[model samples]
Target: MSEKINVGDKAPDFELIKPDGSTFRLQNQLKETNVVLYFYPKDNTPGCTKQACEFRDQYEVFKEHEAEVVGISADSSDSHDEFERSHRLPFVLLSDTGNKVRNLFGVPRKFGIIPGRVTYVIDKDGIVRYIFNSMTKPLEHVKNALEVLKNIEKK
Candidate 1:
């Protein structure tokens, strides 16, 4: 429940362990391209699976726009690895086991058990230009954010 950010705010820097045993630093990775960072609840579950698969479906478009997609969840690295493998996801899945990263991003949730669906579109300059939060229909968020990024670049 941190309300510390709004549009045009500098995106906070973070470093988390990726499922591949590599570390991801926000500022470093996003120095060139826009970032589509989505926080989901669990892997392999129906909602989460659909959302992830949708991202996978549009991976090439995100790449075409020079944007990188990353997913964060409270699940373990092992779980993330399994999910990635099962889904053939072509992007990074970071593990935030302690929920510290989620808290840092101020992702809303319920009962602290399920993660609220939130997507942040960070521009190349590391600023949060757009944020989309939806309680349901999380799978549509990637398309929404992608459209926003496209419109922003058109400007």
Candidate 2:
């Protein structure tokens, strides 16, 4: 794993298959609005479910601000589909089956886990404005991202 990106750093671009079977290029898909890219260890687990549901609960607000949420993991698209269905998620769940995006973002991968809980908020310009790593109380992660986006809205 490389160094974790800092604020204002350019976010790495990658292509992942969308749930609808379309290929999604990170930069291209995010050209119109802010992008909330979060990496988790896996889907269908307790911590991961809590974090994803928190985002789902706040998803409408994120959409209202012209932002889209994407959850990534080494899990297959099938697993993601199951998670989204079971949780009624309203956003895209991307598959990083090869761990390419995980490595590109320098998400910590240790302890036999695919990736640690890391969230990055990328603005329309493809710059990372915030990154949060914590599974406990994951709502704080979404709150921080919204704060940044709200501040940007003020600008």
lDDT of 1 by residue, 45-74 (tens): 888899999999999999988899999998
Taking all chains together, each candidate's TM-score versus the true structure is 0.94, 0.93
Q: How big is the positional error of residue 14 in model 2, measured in Å on the Cα after superposition? A: 0.6
lDDT of 2 by residue, 66-151 (tens): 89998998888889999999999999999988888888888886575646888999989898989988766567778888888888
* Model 1 per-residue lDDT at 118: 85
RMSD of 1: 1.3
Candidate models: Cα lDDT each: 0.87, 0.86
* Model 2 / residue 111 / CA error / Å: 3.8
Question: Which 10 consecutive residues of model 1 have the lowest summed lDDT?
Answer: 1-10
